[model samples]
Target: MTAPSVVVLDYGSGNLRSAVRAVERAGARVTLTDDFDAALAADGLLVPGVGAYESCMRGLRAIKGDRIIGRRLAGGRPVLGICVGMQILFARGVEHGVETDGCDEWPGTVERLQAPVVPHMGWNTVEAAPGSQLFAGVEDERFYFVHSYGVREWELVTNDRTAAPLVTWAEHGGDRFVAAVENGPLWATQFHPEKSGDAGAALLHNWVRTLT
Candidate 1:
């Protein structure tokens, strides 16, 4: 089978080089681009974001990244988001008492975690949802994380019992937040798979396999 072609969106945010290297290592033909056409036409679209939610969203808007994502998903194409990339998929993001609108693909808000320690850095285990293809072989493994805010609660409602969204969880400082989500063609992880070492590599490989 041919290697999956993946576009690592370069919308002025994210660890682009690391993400590209990781995806390439996962056996995908990776392209780092800010072009809307490249992003929309890729076999897989990987959105990787770093830093604050507001700034990430700004960068996405500047390149019309959100529209590209929305358009891809509407066509039932695969799109993966990492860190703040995952956070901005929701309806809104609240940081420093200010709320910014998100892509609204999912109904929820990304808020600061109610944890004693801010920025839950380092490796952490995730409670993968049952039968999660994204965590198929990495259910018991830990992934690298670096963030201060997350979706503390899930609010998306699905009437189709056969296609309910799978929500994964992880805990830090006694606060459990949405670690990953698999909803049809949309997959996202709050942790950085590009930095999660071997476990991350396996997860990316699993996702790439789905494309083939």
Candidate 2:
């Protein structure tokens, strides 16, 4: 089989180089592109973001990234979001008492974690949802994280019959937040897989295998 062609979107946020390298190491052909056409045509589109929610959303919008993501999902194409990239997929994000609208792919809000610490930095383990293809063999592993805000709870409705969408969780300072989510062709993680060492590499491999 041909190597999956993956696009690391250049939307002025996140560690584009690290993400591109990691995805390539996962056995996929990678492209770092700002072109909307190239992004839409790839086997997988990776949206990596760092910094505040509003700013990330601004950068994404500036490149018409939100539209690209929405269109990809509507067509059942694969898209992966990391850190703030994942956070911006929700309906809104509240930081410093301000709420900014998001892509609304999922009905929820990305707010500051109710933790004693401000930025929840370092490695953490995630309670992967049952039968999660993304965490299939690495359920006990930890991933690197660096953030202060995340989705504390999942509000999307998923029936028992169709279980394509699964929500994973993690805790820090007594606060539990959405650690990862796998919804149809859309997959996201609050942690940075590119920086998570071996465990992160395994997770990336799992995701890459899902791509055509």
Cα deviation in Å at residue 104, candidate 1? 0.6
- For the record, the alpha-carbon RMSD of candidate 1 to the native fold, in angstroms, is 0.9
Task: List the candidates' TM-scores in order.
Answer: 0.98, 0.97
- Candidate models: Cα lDDT each: 0.95, 0.95
Model 2, CA-based lDDT:
0.95
For every model shown, the clashing-pair count is 0, 0
Tens digits of per-residue lDDT for model 2 on 1-212? Answer: 89999999999999999999999999999999989999999999999999999999999999999999999999999999999999999999999998999999999999999999979999999999998999988999999999999999899886778665788999999999999999999999999999999999999999999996
Q: List the residue pairs that clash in candidate 2.
A: none
| Cα lDDT over the full model 1 | 0.95
For candidate 2, what is the TM-score? 0.97
